[model samples]
Target chain A: MYVAVKGGERAIDNAHAFLAEERRGDPAVPDLSVAQIREQMALAVNRVMTEGSLYDPDLAALAIKQARGDLIEAIFLIRAYRTTLPRLGYSTPVDTGKMATTRRISATYKDLPGGQILGPTFDYTHRLIDFALAAEGDAPPAPQASPLGDVPRVTGFLDREGLIEEEPASDATPGDLTREPMELPADRALRLQALTRGDEGFILSLAYSSQRGFGRTHPFVGELRIGEVAVEMDISELGVAIEIGEITVTECETVNQFTGSKTQPPQFTRGYGLVFGQTERKAISMSLVDRALRWKELGEDDTGAPVQDQEFVLMHADNIQATGFLEHIKLPHYVDFQSELELVRRLRAGMTEAAE
Target chain B: MGLLARAPADRLAALYPHISEHAVLRGPETGAVMVRGRQGGTGAPFNLGEMTLTRCSVRLPCGKDGHAYVQGRNKDHARRAAVLDALLQTEAIGEVTARVLAPLAEAESAQRTARASKAAATKVEFFTMVRGED
Candidate 1:
């Protein structure tokens, strides 16, 4: 009675059905709306977009709704969706210098060109829970104001006096990590791409590790800026650039003490972090990790540390990729296991016969 | 979805509309067409540049609680696979299950059986002839 057992298709179907039922626990509970998820769970949306590499809040929100609040699954959805999108055109390097900033601050200098505006931050917020929000109560709307004429950037003032270091611009186009494989000895742009898409918690921990004598490079939050930036693409048909839309971006630049190494002089080194939406904490953490990884580039010794190793950093950075690959182990691997089992059986049999 | 074995490039291009029609398809803008793209053989790990992948997800009817995400090399393939998966739930699971999933399994079994029968039929019994040299 050797009937070849086969029911993966049925199993898959039933499993899916089970998952669907589980996603909607109770009929009485109000179903989550895309708008509600987008507005209320904005940080989750920001994380999805950051990891997904798509700036569509609506899509992210939809993904969130569909995934049943599983952020990584939402990210996976976004990534899959984004891959289908056609590459329209590359925008000219965004001038963060001319950014219409809502929150701008410089820890390096208090008296910079544009006075630091601590517009909005959860940094000072107390950890007390608001029990009133359990009823979904709506608060009165905050007052709005017209745009300021000239909202100068902190970096601009530094560039003027040559106080801050300037990264040289190259005519060569930057490599797209999504399209291409990540190669070793990555340039700044490639590194930044890995960092931006990297898991915030992981990066935060790694940055924290560096602070606690792992690869200690005392880093100060030099300038943390959160604002909306115009996304412009040069349309060949239009014969000029056109603004497609605006996206909120959080950019962090950490300034580390330039203790002169053996080879290079003591110049203020910088770590940069940029992410979609207002993610200052993530951006700051990213910057610290970036600086820690750049130790070798600045002719510093490779201390065999986690943050210093580019391969380790880039490989384990993206939560979507890492988690997906990690979770995939749950999938059927019986065939591969069977091969190993067969080998072990043969070897054990041979050993037994020889011993006998 | 239609069963047409298109060139990989065309299949790759077709993925854009299949996954998301709203997706920007600036194929020319990317110069990606000029770059040689090839996918690894079946069951091989997905590598960068070598292969073009088109993944898709569909919401199966909420029977249980979660959505069934069917990923594949082609968008249409993914959609078809998802549909098949969804159908197998409510439909006669036995026949379709064997037909769809173990399509390769059946083929492999047949191949092994054929090989074994062929080997048996052509069995080379080594018998020494008694008076051959004498």
Candidate 2:
């Protein structure tokens, strides 16, 4: 039972005012612009966009700014704002094969077509604190070289000999979680959607757990690429597909060990993760979780693992819902607690009398 | 239309002839387009996420209608793009392409080349030997 208490309206208003003031910080410092956040703190914006399930960088930057750089709070604001906008229509499925790739690499091979272009990675960088960055100074420009050509997917090589599982193309439309209520025993598409937008930390931990032998799949990174793909929409008025814009995305494909089933022979299976912007961590994590979740599909036993528990993962992955349930205790539970208090006291008195 | 939407509003304004009036057939209102991606990048379509976009539908006085969808909430960009689209359908298509699309495409190509060059520099060198195990 719950009661609506009607006090502290002024207090609430004052608290909000104080919050706004605090958000501004010391008056001496210059204010941070949305553009700066969008450009400088790009990874933050990327995470917000992927988890918030929105594609507009500017909106994500604005949300990040308003939330005082609290990412989950920023994601919450984005989701709240997202629900208000009317959905115009659907875009034609983006073709990532034609992506103007900035970064392309494969762990399965030492070298692949288009070579391993490690565009702006932290892999080789020592984790040393570069104090030069803290004070202020411009870094030198990266050297320019002749552009690479034909960055093909590593999975395609295995596909040539039918060594890897074939995921045949289809024109069928997959489920939309935003518009529809989630149903249990979801297909791969639905599961991918949930994982892609799930909290990064939660997904990361789960991925880490799977690798730690909970529900190991013996995963290998077949390919990881970050690039821009054009967004095309079939406009009815124009009677053609129009390229509205382009957005950067990171895609990770994992080749996992697959034991033979009664219906099929031994072959390498694939786990995929594609997310908006250069969010390789989330993308890679998403791929690992995706493979682990495919236990049933692959004819492997569930092993009673948390990774294999689709319902648990999907239902609790959203930070907004999880936080709402956990944070609601902060609200006044006066009546509920009062009843419990009386019951406890009465029970104690009865026990004392019985002892006498 | 794609090139028009991608072009800057100020650039479009400067290049295209001033259209006195046009019927606002649809909207210069902000909405979202549900972006879909393929399964494993080559299979069944699944909803990726919604992208904020502003769209406009306009018909010129000469009856050449245009529709455009531009990324983000800039109503002016959407409207200008739509106006340019309508103008392109008219006899002035050649002039519009020369003035607007050509210059925009050149600039875009230049930017793409610059980015690709930077990326190309980071490609792995096969000849670089790893340290021998102790």
User: Which has the greatest lDDT?
Assistant: 2
Name the TM-score of candidate 1.
0.68
Model 1, position A163, has a per-residue lDDT of 56
Per-residue error for B10 in candidate 2, Å, reads 5.8
DockQ, all models: 0.01, 0.76
Error of 1 at A287 (Å): 1.1
State how far residue A302 of model 2 sits from its true place (Å). 1.5
The positional error of residue A114 in candidate 2, measured at the CA in angstroms, is: 1.3
Model 1 DockQ, alpha carbons vs. true complex: 0.01
Name model 1 segments beyond 4 Å from true: A1-6, A143-149, A261-265, A342-356, B1-134
